[model samples]
Target: MGGFVRANEPEKVISLFEELKEKLGGGMIYDGTPYGNLMKAYFMKGMEEEAMVCYSEVLGEGSKVRFGAVSYNSVLDALGRHEKLDDAIKLFDRMIKEHDPPRRIAVNLGSFNVMVDAYCIAGRFNDAIKVFGEMGERKCTPDTLSYNNLIDQLGKNQLVGQAEELYKEMGERGINPDEYTYILLAEACFGVDRVDDAVGYFKKMVDLGLRPNANAYNKVIGGLVDVGRLDEAQGFFDQMPEKEVKPNVASYELLLKAYVEAGRLDDAIKTAEGILLDESVAFSDEMKELLEGALRKVGREEDIAKMYEDVEREKAERAARAAEEKARAEALAREEEERKKAEAAAKEAAAARASQAAIEAVLGRRKEAAKEESPDGGSNADDGGILKRLGITNGPVEEKRAENGNVVGASVGDESVKQDGEAKEGAGSGGAADQATAL
Candidate 1:
């Protein structure tokens, strides 16, 4: 059944499930596993109606299945994935409500987390806060992930103070804030124009022995760059490599943009050269255009031209390589086609030879049978006559009669023929013609 789900064959899953239910009998008590599987399949197939039907059937009072937390979490996750946050919230509410012993599905931390994230995504911060509060009311302690979701969402929605308060609350609860917590708090402070607070959180992150990744550094650098804090941003940028965190393309781009905006053409050019030095960094067309525009604004046409020339060279080289590859591919395809044609031609020639050999064999056998049937063992004279008619051999020469019914021979060139009945044995004066008659 898991295989069917992984293979994305929802119809097969449904059919197999029906067969299982039939074999197990209608009175069989099902756990959350089967219902979760059904809900997952329906969700994957985007069959909301079918998924709801499955959920309804599982939650039905007469149904023998006792749906658990896993079942409720699975359905909630499905609803979240489909962007049905409203329905997810409703389901979450029902999960928290008291139910009979057999039908009760306790709402877990994962359940609250899903609802909070969904509400945040839908821009309903108040609803998200309400759900977060309910977690406390239900005695479900929020974990790091839960807090992270709310803090990040609150930051994005410009509620940085609230998010900061939550951060303090985490410390008060004896929760050790992880790297993500610090990153989010920093981002929240930055979002609300609290640059110093943002930097403080970043420093706090380092003090906590947490390594700030490229994304975290980029956010801090970008935030500083956003508010004309180029010196501080550059300071952070320079510290990245020292901290063993490599500056990414985004980091370079942000710094370069800040330099260009500050009319620091030399600095921008130097930064671009640095980016070029790092082969790992890909200089995108957008970045290229940005740099070009900056150079143009500063009246650095020579540098602009040089940059365009380099870009053109790179483009030409890439085109040349692509053309070379295409040529090689075409050559290979032609070779393969020619090879097949040659093989076919060889096969046809062999077939033709075999056919000819068979015909010749049949003719030879017919001749041998004819020879055996002949009474005189096939006389040589008859064989010779047949050979002569077929132009296979020379036969006896016949005499040619003249107009007077007498035997005649070749006449000498430019000489009158002998009119007498006597034959001349001597060679004629025309030696060439006499030699021809001698034959």
Candidate 2:
């Protein structure tokens, strides 16, 4: 039957049990090993209704079959797992209260744990505590494991205060809290915003010389991260090494994820480096891929080849590449700026030359006209013609003059002014052609 159960051949076990019953026709089998196996087979085959009926007939009032604590705990677990809480409680009551030989201790510590677990499933946490309290009346004094089991269920449901009461009770009862006990208490504390309580439990565990595993450290660190106590989270991570507890991938991953999300890439990279340094941890591809997928967005992902290489060398290479890229970009920018300035200066010079050429051409034509007009080597009123072509008005307005001995301003447009080729050529500089026509 055990073989059949291990093979998951529940129907075959049941059929064999039925055949054995038939062979023994009018006799009652009071031994519970076979009956318990039958119930397990029923459960294994998902025959919950049949299993429940079988449990009642075998263990109910006036029944000859006597199931010990092992069988009772098994069925209780099944009931708890399947959410058959009410039935589980009723069976638990019978186990504790069964008085054939008046042996209440027939229900072992497992019986109490199972009931606590069942109550936890139903969210009847106070009832779970009550179940533990009733253990004394049942003549079963729970050891550290029993307390740990009950506290584990309470912690799972975030019943921090109740779990703490249990922890307090353990100390009072002289049962030393183990590593798992402290770990569960710490998690429960964190679950209920009691950060100080959580940290204290960790300290308590250490003070008692209990070596916490990577998982224990991770739970405390993760709780600290959850409540935005990032500094404390980082502190715990750092303390792991000091305590001789090596941080695993999960330990680093918790802080890495927190750092990256908080826009702290440097911190994330630092945590990632810690993972690479720990050779004991298999840096599986899934974990590596997860980290890279997250870090890739910020362009801070570790180089896979460099992950296994010399750390300092990898850092140096990355810094060199970044500096080289920066310098190249700056150089390109400076070249672009220089090119633009040179183009602007060259255009200005071209415009100045064009303007000068236009002025020279007009002056040359007037110079020829002046030569032809004054062929007798005397002055004519050619000044007016030259001035008219130059776009200066022929006016008697004395802008500047010297009357006898009195002084005045320079005559900028005095019609009486006379000049030969040199004067006209000199005056051509201040021409009416503005820079607009230069190009």
lDDT computed for candidate 2: 0.76
Once fitted onto the true fold, the runs of candidate 1 whose alpha carbons sit more than 4 angstroms away are 1-51, 80-90, 97-105, 121-127, 133-139, 304-439
Q: Estimate each model's TM-score.
A: 0.56, 0.59
Q: Residues 184-267, candidate 2: write the lDDT tens digits.
A: 998888888889989999989999999999899999999999987888999988998899988887888888778767867667
TM-score (C-alpha, index-matched) for candidate 2: 0.59
Task: List ranges where model 2 is wrong by over 4 Å.
Answer: 1-30, 34-46, 60-63, 97-105, 290-296, 299-309, 312-439
**Residue pairs clashing, model 1:** none
What is the lDDT of every predicted structure here?
0.76, 0.76
RMSD of 1: 17.6
User: Which residue pairs show collisions in model 2?
Assistant: none
